[model samples]
Structures are given as structure tokens and as C-alpha cells.
Target: MSPTTPHQPVLLRLLHSAIALLVFGSLLTGFMVYDRYDKRFGTLNLPIVPNTQGIHGTIALTFLILLPIFAVYCFHIGDRRLVQSQSMQQLGQQLTEVGKPIWWVSLQRLTNTFMLIAATLAVVTGRMMQEIWLPTGELNHIWYIGHLISWIIMAIGIALHLLMSTKVGGLPLLLSIYHWRIRESDLPKNWLKGFKIKPNSSIALIIEFVVIGGIALAFLLPLFVTA
Candidate 1:
């Protein structure tokens, strides 16, 4: 790909960074909240971090404020180049070939759209629970259930997005978020020439293991310590 606008690249990098932090931190805190409040499931306990309620609520609100800004930036400047990118086009073609019903597309889009909205709601409700601003409710079971359901759906959407991205060289796109210094030679010479990146399989595996293990350990540590 040819060099993109400097401002746009910088903005994309910032948005990506913020989103990554929010997602990881919020997921960790969510597990903590589950462990503390919903202990019926024996496997749910984890002590990777303490004081999770406050930490999670804070991060959620921070992300809530950041999302609209990122969304607007994405709409105004980001999505066009991203959608037109060779990787994304290939990914779309693969999805189309999957031969799922039209409802699948509709459902995916609906779930994704509402997942963002639901995340916002979860953040707001979490803040209310924290008394950081004002109480929205009494923190009843229904509200907690809604928050958990929304989070699960959002996580599912994220997983789907990751799976689909792999078809379109997802690792490179992910790397581009952090490593922006692509050589000019790496660019596609023509539409016929494909874009490719060096495969660092060991690094990839380490990252995968760390993330999956971190989440699992976050849940199990508390139980082992207690035992």
C-alpha cells in the first residue's frame, strides 16, 4: 500500500491503542467482577487483580468517552481507506463465498452495532454503580445480567472479527497498528502484486499463549490461593 496521510495514520494508531487497552483491561475487570459476585460457578474465581470493581468501572467510562470520538473519526476519515484496502476486500470476498444466509450478514451487523451500544451502556451503568457520577439504579440483578450478556456478545463479535481478519492477513493489519514503519518495497507494486509480510510464528504463538493464559490464570489464581 502507498503511504497514507500522516494525520490519518497517527489518528488510527491512537484509536487502536486506546481500544486495545480498554478491551484488555475491561475484560480482566469483568472477570474479577464475576468472580466476586457470581460465585455459584466454581471455576469463576480469580485473583489476578484486586479492587476490580473500581478499576473496571474507571476503564469502562474512559473507553465510553473515547468510543464516540473514535467512531466519528472512523466515519469521517478512516473507513474508506480501510474498506478499500486489498486485505479487507479479500476478506469480504471470502465471507461472501461462505454462502451463509442473508440473515447471517444482517445478524452479524446487528450484533456488532448493538454490541458497541451495549458496551457504552455497560460502561455508563458501571459508573453509576461506582457512584462516580450518580446512581442510575439500585444495582439490581437484572442490570448485572444485562451487563454480562452484553459483554459476552461483544466478546463474541470480537472473536468473529479476529477470525475473519486472518483470511485477509489479519496479523499484518494488527502489526500495522503498532509497527507503522513499512518499507516502500513492501508495498504492492500493482493490483496484481499481493501484499505480504514476514511471518514471525514464534512471536505469534507467544502472544497467543500469553493472552489466553493470562485470562485463564486470572480466573484460576484466586481459587488456588484460597485452597
Candidate 2:
């Protein structure tokens, strides 16, 4: 395939679009909910939505439902790209590697990892927070605090994701996902065949799973603390 030609896999494109919508929706509604209830860090005076908390909760549930599918696809098909190399001898070497496709790809993977982690944290913490609990005069719930932190992380993670995607793939890579012309051989039926594991993929898969587990652990911490 030519470098400029759009060549994203059909399934990956679909899943990416679906997950992006859910994640962005959750971010928007979650921010509204935060602004309405928890402006302890100051306020943006963002437009208030009716039943903002309920709307945010619904978006969160939708995100959680779709997250597993994306997570699995990422691990099974995209895990090799997601795992960082353990052979980096120094931070300087890694910094020198920037601007190349490999570096951008690695940056993309790392950003995706953190984005997933932050999203999970937000969902888990938001679920733990009582539905009736609003900031009102003052708020002191541990889950609420955790949710705030996750929201901040999610925002930063998403910002980095966009920047890195642009830096690495530019318009061609970004547009590839939105482009609709899948090659005849790259249809949905061929997706499973393409997912066959590589010879050295076990180590990469292990790293991917470890990262995912650590993110889940972040989500579970509040429950353990509050218990």
C-alpha cells in the first residue's frame, strides 16, 4: 500500500470510531457533571445540561460496555505495537528516537495505554460515587476525589493522544480511519486470520496484560480504601 493511501483495517476503523465517540461523549458529559457539582478547583461556567449527572452516568455505562471489546481487540491484534521495548538503555536514547515513525508509533501506544487507564479510572470511580451525592456546599467522598483525579488524567491523556497522532501519522493516518474503502482482501471475514500471533509475541502480550492490570488496579483502589 502506498504511504498516502488509506489502509486501516475495517474492523479496527469501526471499533476506533465507536470507542472514540463513547470516550469523547463520556468526557463531555463527565465535565458537565463536574462543573455542575464539583467546582472546587474553580468553575468554567459551562452550559448546564438538564439531568447532567444522570446523563453522565448513562454515558459512563455505555463506555464501560464497549470498553471490553476495544480492549480485547487491542490486545489480540494490536498488542505488539502497544508494548514498550524493555531494552532502552537510557532516557536520552529514547528522547533521541522521537520524530521517527517508530517513535511516534510508540508514543501512540503509550498514549493509548494511559487513555484507557484514565477512562477506566473515571468509570470505576464515578460508579462508586453515590448517585445522590453532589458537591452542594462541600463534598468529602473519597470516590468523588478519585473521580476528579481521573477526569484530570483523562483530559491530559486525550490531549497527548491527539498531538502524538498528528505528529506521527499526520493527515493520512488520521484520515485512514474515516476512509471507507477497505481492500477486497481486508474485509471483516479476513480480520481473524490476520490476528495470528507473531513468534516473539508472548513477551509483548505479557507486557500488554501487565499494563492493563495496573490500570484496573488504579480503578479498584478507591473501593479498597473506602471499604
Question: Against the unseen true structure, what C-alpha lDDT does each candidate score?
Answer: 0.51, 0.71
Off by over 4 Å in 1: 1-8, 48-50, 81-115, 128-140, 182-227
TM-score of each candidate structure, all chains considered together: 0.56, 0.80
Could you give me the TM-score of model 2 versus the true structure? 0.80
For residues 1-227, could you state the per-residue lDDT of candidate 2 as single tens digits? 23695578788888889888877888788778878877778889998779988887777777776776777677777565454554232212556675656666766777776776677777777767777678454467788888888888988987898887777777777788889886876776787754644423554566556545644654566567652
Worst 10 residues of 2 by lDDT: 83-92
Candidate 2 wrong stretches, greater than 4 Å: 1-3, 86-99, 135-138, 196-227
Provide the clashing-pair count of each candidate structure: 0, 0
Tens-place lDDT per residue, model 1, 134-184, is 123333454465666667766876776555433333466445667655454
lDDT of 2 at 7: 79
**Candidate with maximal lDDT:** 2
RMSD of 2: 3.7
Overlapping backbone residue pairs in candidate 1 total 0
Candidate 1 deviation (Cα RMSD):
14.8
